[model samples]
Target: MALRITDECINCDVCEPQCPNTAISMGPEHYIIDPDRCTECVGHFDEPQCQVFCPVECIEVDPDHTEDRETLEAKFRRLAVS
Candidate 1:
């Protein structure tokens, strides 16, 4: 599944750059994750780099954009080609 930055995010500028897919960006309030580009770091890393680097622990799975591992892998593959 893709991830979302909750309102709890402190805007510490920690998770944005950690995203391999460039899915994370500064939103009006805090960092937001684009589900279209998010693969939970499936093809890029063993774990989600954004989650790894986020100190506030505000990032969480996006319930509104849930996806399976295989789907994430496919997205990752597609992203790699572009």
Candidate 2:
């Protein structure tokens, strides 16, 4: 699943640099994650990098964008190949 920054986000910019896929970006209100680029850190890390670094715990899985492990892996693979 892709993570979404909550309104609780402080816009600290801490999470931006932590994303290996460059999925996270600045928003007018808060940081945003591009779902097309988000692999939940599967291709690059053992865990979600953004979740680990978000100071306010604002990063959480988007239930609406949920995907199985295989799908997530495939998504990462596609990104890698591209």
Candidate 3:
């Protein structure tokens, strides 16, 4: 599943740089995760880097954009080629 930034985000600026896919960006209020680019760090790490680094634990799985590991891996591979 892709991850999302919640309103609880403190705008700590930690999550943006941690995203290997460059999916996190500053939104109107807090950081937002682009589902199209989010791979949950599958191609880069065993765990999601942004969630690990978010100080407030505001990052969570996006229920509306859920994807299995295989799908995430495919997306990661596609991203790698581009």
lDDT to native, each model: 0.92, 0.89, 0.95
Taking the tens digit of each residue's C-alpha lDDT, what string does model 2 give over 1-82? 8878889999888999999889999888888999888999997999998999887899999987988889989999999888
RMSD of each: 0.7, 0.8, 0.5
Model 1: residue 47 alpha-carbon error in angstroms: 0.9
Ranking by lDDT: 3, 1, 2
Error at 61, model 1, angstroms? 0.5
TM-score of each model, in listed order:
0.96, 0.94, 0.98
Model 1 C-alpha lDDT per residue in residues 1-82, reported as the tens digit of each score: 8998999999999888888899999999888999999999998899999989888889899999999999999999999999
| Model 3, C-alpha of 11: deviation from truth (Å) | 0.4
The candidate with the higher lDDT, 1 or 2, is: 1
Shift in Å, residue 28, candidate 2 = 1.9
**How well does candidate 3 match the true structure, expressed as C-alpha RMSD?**
0.5
Candidate 2: minimum summed lDDT over ten consecutive residues — where?
A: 1-10
Give the runs in model 1 whose Cα sits over 4 Å from its true position.
none
